[model samples]
Target: MARFTTSTLSKYLLQAQVAAQALHTETAPVPPEVHVPLRKQLKDEAKKQKAAGKKKKKNANNQVVDGWELTVGIEIHAQLNTAKKLFSAATTSFNDDPNTRVAFFDLAIPGSQPIFQKETLIPALRAALALNCQVQTVSRFDRKHYFHWDQPSGYQITQYYEPFARDGSITLQARDGIAAEDGDGVMIGIKQVQVEQDTAKTLAQPGGVHWLDFNRVGAPLIEIITLPEIHHPATAAALVRKVQILLSAVDSCVSGMEAGGLRADVNVSVRRGDDPSAPLGQRTEIKNLSSFKAVEDAIIAERDRQIAVLETGGVIEGETRGWSIGSTETRRLRGKEGEVDYRYMPDPDLAPLVIGDDLVSHLRESMGQLPDVEVDVLIKEFELTPKDALSLTALDGGMRVEYFWNVADALAARLGLDRIENLACFQLAANWILHELGRLTSERSEAASEELGFTEDGQCERLPVEQLADILFYLHTRKITAKIAKELLWVVFRGTIPEKYPSVLGAIEEENLWFDELSETEYAELADEAVEGQEDVVRQFVDYKQYPQGKLMFLVGRMIRLGPEERIDPKNAERVMRAALPEKYVPALKASD
Candidate 1:
């Protein structure tokens, strides 16, 4: 055996000391007798450190011993990319005709055996590679026994004693605004990632009736655990967002939160660095947080609850809790279980995964540039802000980023504009997609429930990406006012645009029928016609040199209400109204203009 060097021995001794010191202040039961030797080793390491004139770095945010500092970790369960279930040949598609995709093995019928799919292993390997983790050549699955109505099998197959990968890192950013960057941020570390299977979903209905959908049962999932390095609620949310983006970039993992493709389990604990020897407070595992806002709220609520418990001298018990997003609180669901609680036994049906060089090579080749590297490239090559780059790369849907890039390039070409390649433009696209499009879709969906057939929902649902891009480009070119764009978008949503418009001086042609029905000359004449009918408002405008701002819109509104029959062009209506109005009133008309 090789002799231990002074530095190596010193390092081990210091770690042992820290462990021993931590154990000493515990009010709970003492550790096993085996820890005594570990304590001695730690003392030896501390002495070695002293001799070497070294001091451990202090924590970033220093607080008094009595103050609270949270220790947060996340365990993300991402469904693997596979055509079928892990142990069965049943399809794993979501929202499919229920029970139709299940095989006998998935239903756990008598005498039905489990057989692992080889394609499933490839995604796990690819995920491990994407995470920069050390993949174990001989990882084995174990049985995680549990009893639930949806789980046909008595236990879930998971990796415990030896996981597929161990030790990794992911970096993210915290933005200053909902979609803006201008804030301080830090890097967090990943602990490990393991492959597992998802349980079926339980849907509860009114009248106390519950339904079980086994459509998702036995679907492969990867659980990624992070170190307790996060310091703030916002950072925790941002980290999850980053992970979603990274997973999406890796083609194997779907990154849709709405589709239930990804889920997160957050672990939170509080400790005082000044008293590192003292045991950290009880940890709470927040279960299955599906949204970033919910995760942040849960973290804040858990931290506050933990602080309250400590202030009252009440012992914080370790347990699993469910987050109530509406109430912004966590309710204890069950007691925390140790590894032994699951009775983890090696899975007998599936053989050990023997990772070969070719397998590793194939996975590596499949791995494209990860989000972080791509963000860096965007910043360097396109002169994008760190926040902007992160926003573009952090989109949950894989195609959103690509679509954004395509639109940005198209806009650049159409407008003869530079900096189209900049990530800031991509960030703009992300903001619009996440906020504007999302809000529009949601509002339209609600309206559809009570409204007629030709509603915004129908229009929005049919809105195409190319048309949206064209509208945006038109706005950017200043060819259309914001108001006109909005109207045109509604038109596009409800009607079709012609191939071309008639020349400004030419007789309106059939191709420009929509506009021809609302010709500029006709609109000017309508404004004149409206003046004849609304002489009182027109007299007020001429005498006071200003019409009531309300009346201006009302007049314009009348002309527009005339539709194509009255032949009113909105732009010409505004122009004719301004030209006919007195000088003082013209400014008000211009303001409307």
Candidate 2:
């Protein structure tokens, strides 16, 4: 029942050991009912002790809550995709050969020097600009002292006091039914965004010793903190996903939860608004939420835990907690650390980042259509639904939206139609990408026998986007049936272009053009051969035409199936079957015919 910090938990465990000696001698292991009541008493005592400790540290000037308002904020760390470290020339690649990428400056040896990499700084600026932040012309870095084996520097060089940007806002659309609407629209807000440096990774070992990998040290990192505008766990998850998309759109940040490029620190606090003077309860910070689902789960569990504490007239302590994904519970790590003087000052070794007028103009000019702009354009120009546009532009990989539109435009041209100009093509493209191409690629990636690099060009065993798009478009235009198109697409992806048409179309044309290449006599002979192959069905159809409509269609189906390499007109086969039927059977076959 007691809310304790990691340090406090250790103390309590030590105290409990001393107290247990006396209690064990005075009491005996008893019946279940007695033990239950005794445990409850001990829990109540613990809760009292926890509340008394928290009350001593309460700040009187902090905001008071009545009961209904819940405050939520997020700290997002997005890794920048720069070739070098922010403050050092060390390579900023992930999962590299351990400490090999570390430069002397990164290692922080005595008399070691530091040099700011413009490559990293520019991308960080671009990201801040994309986030709608006011870029600071002069920013400074400071040494944040922390003890960790991986941090050979004994401190992390990061921008804390004067960040590259501040007061930025990102607009995100909440899922329907998540947020309350004002008249007709829902509202979201952003707090701020700051730039920082990433820490080294700690690889776990069996005996609690971790192998330090400094490859990630000094990597440029941007932290985008949001206002507690989010009302639900689901909404928080959604906002994180939207931020990922926005970061990815700028091409400065590599945003992926699985790849450790994006991570979130979720802060959850609960309040009761019914009482006007009720205190705003303590908040718990859930650290390192790597995935969106983990963010949601941690928030939900923290919220519930805080609510229970308040209901029992207890207090929640402000502390950092770790989320256990396997158990879906939050364990207190440490109490909030007091703010330290970072001793922030401009680096004498590196020049201040000055944003000239011309550079700003060029950057603005080079900025392509951003995700939000693309979403709006897709809806207005292409007449797509908001949901559809969002999905098309929200992917984390490749030029999905552009590629989709390009292929859609190409198909429209082939059909002698104008560009989408309406929602029809947008809807069609969404369905094709999500249901067919996306599904196929995901499945194939999972099934690969070896390392199948998605970004590799002309990989012998990889699928091509062009080939997939062509097949889908062909099927969309009714140039091939669903079944035939699927088969042909598989063949094309496997690096084999069927010899029907010159390519996919040629293969499709081969099916229909088989009859064109043959003489009339030859075509007639082929039809006779098809009939002879299904003599049993033919005799039954000749005897009882009405009873074998399905059988007749099956027989015609087989004729096409058998001569897949040879073109046969499905319409002509039906005509020939009707003509070959006996006179007595013809009258009864009218309905099926």
Residue by residue across 1-593, what tens digits does model 2's lDDT show? Answer: 33435465345333333333332442322212112232344357557766666322121222223345566789889998788887877788764555556655554544657777777766667777777777776777666777666566667776666776777776655432133322223345555566667886665544443445556777888888777666566667777877777777777786577567899998888887676467655678899987776776677767767877888989778788998542235899988655434555554555556666676567667867778788878777777777767777775353666666666665666656777543465466667654555555563554434322343122223444555556766656545655676677566655567433457666666555222333445445555566664545655765553677787687566556656433455766655555655543344445455
Q: How close is candidate 2 to the true structure, as a TM-score?
A: 0.70
Per-model C-alpha RMSD = 17.6, 14.3
Q: How accurate is candidate 1 locally (lDDT)?
A: 0.64
Which ten residues in a row are the worst by lDDT in model 2? 55-64
List lDDT for all candidates, in order: 0.64, 0.63
Tell me each candidate's TM-score: 0.65, 0.70
lDDT of 1 by residue, 20-74 (tens): 3442443333222221232344467667767788753332232112466777788
Model 1 clash pairs are: 13-45, 14-45, 16-42, 17-42
Error of 1 at 177 (Å): 8.3
Q: Kindly report which residue stretches of model 1 are placed more than 4 angstroms away from their true locations once superposed.
A: 1-66, 176-183, 205-211, 337-340, 373-396, 415-474, 490-495, 498-593
* Shift in Å, residue 579, candidate 1: 20
**Looking at candidate 1, what is the lDDT of residue 536?**
58
